[model samples]
Every structure is written in structure tokens, then in C-alpha cells.
Target: MRLIRGMAGAVLLAGTGLAVHPAHAQQPGFHRHDVLQHDLSVPGREVVQVRVDFDPGAVSVKHSHPGEEIAYVLEGTLEYEIEGKPPVTLQAGQGLFIPAGANHVARNVGKGKASELATYVVRKGRPIFVVAD
Candidate 1:
């Protein structure tokens, strides 16, 4: 179907570089799905939503968002760490917000795959995510 093909292309593009870092290759079973993107009613703003899946023991490198980010766990458990705060474990039905420009990392700490829905309110034409040293 057309929709399936489009989704597959989006996923491939997102994984190629739009949302993933080269270092991500070291993390097995990590996948990012570009769910939707739309220009916000507010000028110069856009809302992008993605579904991120992390297999057991997978971890992401530190990164920052170009704008505010909100994430909700859909399944399993995620260990999230943001600069200046202690890491927190979020289970299904829980969510967290990350202020713009804050460095953060996420890891799958559960026995199964962890999935989360992430929404970002970002500046138009800017990369939604940036790798942080």
C-alpha cells in the first residue's frame, strides 16, 4: 500500500540521519519511526512526532533537542537522564518533558523492547535533534 511504503521510506530516511546519529550503529535493536510532522498554527514552529523503540539493554548517546520535547512511554521501561537531574525510570503510561537545549539520554532498562512516543515543538527548518558531546 502507498501508506506503508511512505512510512517505510520515512523510517529509512529518519534512520539514515534525520533523527539518528552514526554512533547509534553500536546500539542494537534501536529504531526510530517518523510518525508525523506538521507546521504549527504558530508561525515558524513545527510539531514532529516520532515513535522510538529500544531493545533490551540498548542505550542512546547524549543528545539535545532544538526545541521542547515531550515523551510518553508506550511499553516496557525507559531510563532517562537529563543534565543536572538524576536519571528517572519511566514505565508505560508515564511521560516526561525536556526543556529546549537540555542534554539528555535514554536507555532501555527493561527485559523487553521499550517504546515511546516523542513529540517535539521545534523551529521550522531546524533539525529536531542534535548530538551532544
Candidate 2:
């Protein structure tokens, strides 16, 4: 629990402006579990954010990260793919980091819903660098 709180504080200090309430801190709700969260905003530098969600089949598009990303599989499985590497299968309680300029994608590869959390430290105004080519 202390680790989760520390992570949450780091996220808040790294943001430009985010409206979060203590009442909703670390609780499971609709769409996401939100075990913790942090915004990524650095003045004249980079932006960093962390998101924790609880659900199955939640996914993002195939894209690249302009900066670096660290993702932790808190409670479920996820199918992860990078542009030039063999796809990776992440199970519950696992985590991986994607380096800057690396193209990748992720999806819930499990049969049912899965929950996971991700923290990204990225260049400001640029997050996912998706190319259709």
C-alpha cells in the first residue's frame, strides 16, 4: 500500500493539471480500477503519466512510443507486439519496459478481461507515434 501511495504522488507531481480526488484514490470503479495514477508533464522537457486499470480486453492501437514506457500486468494477461521483435505474452504480475523510438502494440490476449497498469515517460505533446506504413 505504501508503494502504491508513493507511485501516486510521483504521478501528481509530474503533471500540468489533473483533477483527481482523494475519495476516488486507489479504488475500483467503472471502466478502470485506478489502483493509482500519475500525469506526465514536465516544463520545457517531457511528460510522464501512469495509469492503472482493471478490466479485460482493454487495449490501445498499434503504435510507437516517442519516449520510454514501463508497463506492469497487475492482474491479467496482455498480448504485446513490437515492430521488429517477436510478440511477447505477459501474464498477471508481470511488467515490461519499451524503449524510446520503439514501435509496438498491446492487447488483451487472454480469454477474458484482464487488468494492468502502465507508466510512460515521454516527450511533451507527443505520446504514441503510430505509423500506418
Identify the candidate with maximal TM-score.
Answer: 1
Judge candidate 1 against the unseen true structure and give its global Cα lDDT, from 0 to 1: 0.78
Off by over 4 Å in 1: 1-13, 16-27
Q: State TM-scores per candidate.
A: 0.81, 0.58
lDDT of 2 by residue, 68-109 (tens): 778888666787887788989989888888888776767776
**lDDT on C-alpha atoms for all candidate structures:** 0.78, 0.56
What is the lDDT for 40 in model 2?
39
Q: Candidate 2, after superposition: displacement of residue 93 in Å? A: 1.2
Which residue pairs show backbone clashes in model 1? none
Q: Pick the lDDT winner.
A: 1
In the range 47-126, model 1's lDDT, one tens digit per residue, is: 88888888899877677788999999999999999999999999999999999999988989999999999998988877
